[model samples]
Target chain A: MLAKRIIPCLDVDKGRVVKGKKFQDIQDIADPVELALRYNHEGADELVFYDITASHEERKTFLDIVEKVAATINIPFTVGGGIRSVEDIYQALQSGADKVSINSAAITNPTLIETAASKFGSQCIVLSIDAKEINTGKWNVFQNGGRIDTGLDAIEWALEGERLGAGELVINSIDVDGVKKGYNLQLTKTIANAVYIPIVASGGAGIMEDFYQVLHSDIADAALAASVFHYNTISIPALKNYLVEKSVPVRSVPSCQLY
Target chain B: MIAIVDYGAGNIKSLQIALTTLSIESTLTRDETVIRDSNAIILPGVGAFQDAMHQLRSDNLDKILQEQAAAGKPILGICLGMQLFYETSNEGGLSTGLGLIKGKIERINANVKVPHMGWNTLQIRRNKHITTNIPDQTYVYFVHSYYATDIDNDDLIATSQHGENIPALVQHNNIIGMQFHPEKSGDVGMQLIKNFWEMVS
Candidate 1:
């Protein structure tokens, strides 16, 4: 049986991890590589490094961080945020990222998804959608960090992304992001049912039960969280044990000494 | 030294990085001489079967790899590289492979997801050198839409379930293949790499 994945997302700016707080054991929590290694050791199925750096010059530093993380960890990781073109995707993958996630650029230029998927297999092209519930049971895709509404139906956009050759979809619910309540199960389940590719549920993961509810219910193939993991609100091993107790199959946290 | 056969199929930077982390020297080269001189060869690929086979044949790597296998030089094929070891693949049309293993590649006709992309436990079928020190039901990462079917039972070393009995690992004498990307499979993957290195050494 394929095990459910637990992912830790890190926001990187100018090569340093952002929002990384409350890690006394880690000498430098700001170091993306160090944090990534910490996650890998704790049995994170994959890692996501969102390059939130805005300056073009600082983007080079983000790529450097990608290289360092790639060299340090063996688990698959995705580099997302600010990926605008096929050239950007190529640069990220060339710098050792297994996959690159595209958000706003994908909405503005949907063909970018097709071109990138054709150039660098669909398996490496991840379509990340930022969605918010605008009306009863209706969600709209948002851009620019949920500031602008694109008016694209969340489910429709997910279907289009799959049709456009996106191998996976990361559906992030803006309403539930950082809410600590739970994942927008209705929204994620709707999109997951609409698409054939794997759907990664993002934004709302407050407790280990939130993960169990989303994953065990089969609403999402993987659950990605940032603040909870970054702040030590939820430790990965303990979470996996909880999931296992709930009969949710998860990869056992392997001893890192083998490597 | 290991020569990673490069035919422009997929990004092999992670594979090189993994080898470096294992303190093993490797080079990504299409040059026949470099491949011939290396202690072992790691065939890493990601893409459709026909396109990859096309690139290999165009660069004369098909014949070179055949010669290496004939000479008993250990060869490890990862993902699509492993698929190329079969006799035929139906992806992108019915195309021939290296024919080192007796099987044909076909789309996974299972109820689950098409691309079985995640960590799955291995069911070691037979004891082999590659399975050394590896625990039974060990988890490894896999990402693919097709799988090898009708393979000889003797060559099957391990299997993983994903709506069907997916061949996770196979070996026939000096030729070995893994349907998953060991480089991205975390510690168990690195252990497999180390074991392969030990076999070659």
Candidate 2:
């Protein structure tokens, strides 16, 4: 059985993590590379580092951060935010990211996904969606960090992502941004049910039960949260242990779970 | 000194950093003499099998690894390197492997996730000396689509569940292979590497 993964996503801008409050006003958090190391030590299954605007700004800082993150941490890290081309993906992979995620670029140039998948293998690419609910009970797609609405249905766009060579899909709920109320389980489940690829549920994780809620749900393959993990409100090892004891099917280092 | 065969595959530095953490001196090299003289050999790799195999073949390190494994001095392969220890690979129109293990590498069934990428807990089915009776279920990190499948049950030391029965650890006497990245697996990973280092000591 594949263990359900709990990921911590750090949205980095200019090397500092910024959590978009309501997917708008961004606030400084911490140095991304240091945070990455902390999460790696804390037993995070995997990490997502979105260099929020690497594509637009052409910030070379991501590479430096990635190289250091790769050197300092041992866990698998995925680099995203402004990855528009195969060459960009290759550069990130060379910088030590286990995977590269694409957003706006893939929407603009769907062939970039095919080219990247063919060159680096589909497993290296992750299709991320910043989703917001719209009228008529349908969710709309947002790019450039939810600032631009593409008027695309979330589910259809997700299927296109998988079709265009995305190995995984990250359905990040813009509505649940920093709420800590719980995850947008229904939205996550919707995407997970739609795609054959592994789906990582992101946004609105407030408690340990939220983690379980996502993992036990039929639609989610993984759950990702930020503030809770960064603040140590609940430790990943503890959460994993609790889930393991509950027989919810989670992966945890042996000693931590047993004790 | 231990020799880490780095043929521009994966992050070879992780292993070097791991060795440093273990206080075990090592050098990253493709030099035959450096590899031949080292007390132990480690083959670390990632990326596509065909491209990685091409680099190894071009460097002529495949023959060296084959000879070294045959000599029965501890030789460990991680991830793609572990797949290379098999008889042949289904990757890219079939390529010959180092034949260190009597098995072939095949693609994982597409029904399950294509790349079984994530953290998976290890079930130590066989109580072997290398594992040192570490608890039955230990979590380790993994990131690969293909695994040594339909393998002989005897060769399997540990396993991870992911729809397909993934071999967490495999050993044929002194030649050992781990499907996960022990270097990046944190404490559990470091302990496994520490155990491997102990084998040479």
Candidate 3:
């Protein structure tokens, strides 16, 4: 049985970990590697480091942070943000990352996904969609940290991503980003059902039950969170124990700190 | 020193990190001289069968690997690298393999998840070099859409329970192939690597 994954996303900027209310007014958390080791100890299936930067210098720092986190965590970790070319994906993978995620780069140059997939295989490439509900309930894809709208339909983009060899799809609900109401079930299902690749549900995980509800459905193979984990609201071991109680099949937690 | 063949397929850092943690001295290389002189070889890949074959052929490293295996130099194939060891693969389209083992690669049934992306326990069928001390039902990480099939030989040392019996480990003397990434599979995975290193040493 495939284990259900619990991932905590850390937004990296200038080598510091930050989480924002809907990705705005960011608040500094701990160092990226520090928080990563904590979760890795707590039995986190994986970690995602989103490099949210607006400057080239800061982006370089994000790579440094990624290298540090990759060194710190024993589990699989993914890095995304400001990646625009095949060389960027290669550098990230070579820097010790197991996966390299892309958003705006894929939307701007769909060929980048093809090139990266061809070079590094689809398993290393992840397509993250920042989806926001527009008027009348149609979902729109957002870029530049959810500030600029690409006007591309979320479902259509996901389908194309799969066609272009995206190994996984990360459906992040913009409306539910930090709202913690719950996952956007409908949107997640739409993309998960459309693409044959694995789908990871991102955004809107407030409690253990939220994870239960979202995973019970066929929407996502994994769920990602940041604040809940950073604040230590729900420790990973306890959460996995709860899921085990609920009969949610998961990987056996490492009995001790692997490091 | 061990040599990890880098033909531009997947991440080699995890394996390098694992090797370093174990105090195992190894080099990530594609140069034929370095690989041929190494004590053992670790061939890792992550990609479509055709693309991997293309890369291996283009780099002319395929011949060196075959020669090493022929010389009875222990070679380990991790995940996609293992798939390439088979005779043929039907992933995406039918493609030729390295013919190191008598098997074929096929896609996991669509009814089950397209990519078997997580941990599952190993069920040892026949105890061998890789499964010498690995307890039955010990879980290891896996991530792939295709699986090795059409193997009628008893070289299938272990199996992992899925919707069906998926081949977990298959070994033939010095040449061993692992369907899972032991390097990324934590301690158990490291144990497998350490055991291999001991064999070649």
Please report the candidate that would top TM-score against the real structure: 1
DockQ head-to-head 1 vs 2, winner: 1
Best by DockQ: 1
lDDT of 1 by residue, A213-239 (tens): 999977899999998898799999999
Q: Can you write out model 3's per-residue Cα lDDT over A22-73, one digit (the tens) per residue?
A: 5678899898888888887677887898887737778677777777776665
Cα lDDT of candidate 1 equals 0.90
- For model 2 the TM-score comes to 0.90
Q: What clash pairs does model 1 have?
A: none
Return the interface RMSD of model 1. 1.1
Q: Write the per-residue lDDT of candidate 2 for residues B37-111, one digit (tens) a residue.
A: 999999888778888888999999999998998887799899998999998899878988888888889888756
Candidate 1: TM-score of chain A is 0.95
Tens-place lDDT per residue, model 2, A1-259, is: 5678888988888778887775577788899878887787667878888776565554687788888888787777898877877778888988878789888888889899888887777877898888999864589999755678899999999999899888899888888868888888788878887777889888889999888888885668888888888778988888988888778877655444111
Which has the greatest lDDT? 1
- Which residue pairs show collisions in model 2? none
Cα-based lDDT for every prediction:
0.90, 0.83, 0.83
Ranked by DockQ, top first: 1, 3, 2
Task: Please tell me which model should have the higher lDDT, number 1 or number 2.
Answer: 1
Candidate 3 lDDT, tens digit per residue, B45-163?
88778888888899898788888889999999989999998899998789898888889999887577666776778888887666655777777778788888888567798887666
RMSD of 2: 2.9
